[model samples]
Target: MRISKWGDSLGVRLPKAIVEELRLKPGDEVEIVAATREKLVLQKADDRMTAFTRMAERRLTMPEDYIFDREEANKR
Candidate 1:
């Protein structure tokens, strides 16, 4: 795929075969995974949050009184 200027932003036109194979449309979102300097992989974005909650659920535990200090936090 070649990158071209789209208005002020850069974009690439995916081949018709790959688009059809991935079931991608005009407004579909994809996650770009950069594996190396010359290679970029695209994946359909899943609706899973990959931040703290998922990792915390698997590795971390808390007490029953694990209260969030709302007012203290809001001050920042």
Candidate 2:
């Protein structure tokens, strides 16, 4: 862990490897969530679409074609 003094703010430096592993950039926003008394969650800030995207991805089922069955329509 590296420590640096940035003018008035004291900063703790996170390792580049850890940052890259988390897919975080310098300008990326983060969210700090408090789950338990001792457990604190540090996570990436979620966008409005994050939940929607995951839900859509999870609900995807492809055993058969989802497209219009044009030939079946003509038979009917």
Candidate 3:
């Protein structure tokens, strides 16, 4: 793919074959998982619940004395 100027940033237009293969549609999001001078890897962005589920699977632990302040969270 050839990179072209997009406003102030550079962008690449995916060909029709790749678009169909990936089942990509307008407004769909993709993330660049890895990049180097000669190579780049892209993957579809995960949905919110999928990300949350992955986080849950990690089974992170909190401090025993930690407390959540609902009012503080709500303020954010």
Candidate 4:
């Protein structure tokens, strides 16, 4: 791979082979981690935060005894 100047910062043009190997698509989120001074790793983001936020929008039913510690919590 080769790095090219994009306006100011340098950018690398991912080859078709790499895109297919990593199963990457346009507009997908990726993360870069520096493993060593001469090495870099690229990976897809887990998107856990987005998943948690989506889960938070749903309603969940709790068990009848789920409030067993409510009295203790109220003392705080």
lDDT per prediction? 0.79, 0.73, 0.83, 0.76
lDDT of 2: 0.73
Report the Cα lDDT for residue 70, model 1. Answer: 86
Output the TM-score of candidate 2.
Answer: 0.43
lDDT string, candidate 4, 1-76, tens digits = 8889999899888888878887888887778865788888887666866575666677544465765577898999
Off by over 4 Å in 2: 34-40, 47-76
Ranking by TM-score: 3, 1, 4, 2
Hey, what RMSD does candidate 3 come out at?
7.8
lDDT winner between 1 and 4, please give it.
Answer: 1
Best candidate, TM-score: 3
Q: Per-residue lDDT tens digits of candidate 3, residues 1-76? A: 8889989999999989878877889998888899999988887676865666776799865578988799999999
lDDT of 2 by residue, 15-44 (tens): 787688779988877777667886546777
TM-score for each predicted model, relative to the true structure: 0.55, 0.43, 0.60, 0.53
Q: Which stretches of candidate 1 lie over 4 Å from their true place?
A: 48-76
The RMSD of every model to the true structure, in order and in angstroms, is: 8.4, 11.3, 7.8, 12.8
Pairs of residues clashing in candidate 1: none
Q: For candidate 1, report its TM-score.
A: 0.55
Screening candidate 3 with a backbone cut-off below 3 angstroms (N, C-alpha, C), the clashing residue pairs are none
Using lDDT as the measure, the top candidate is: 3
Better of 1 and 4 by TM-score: 1
At residue 52, what lDDT does model 1 achieve? Answer: 52
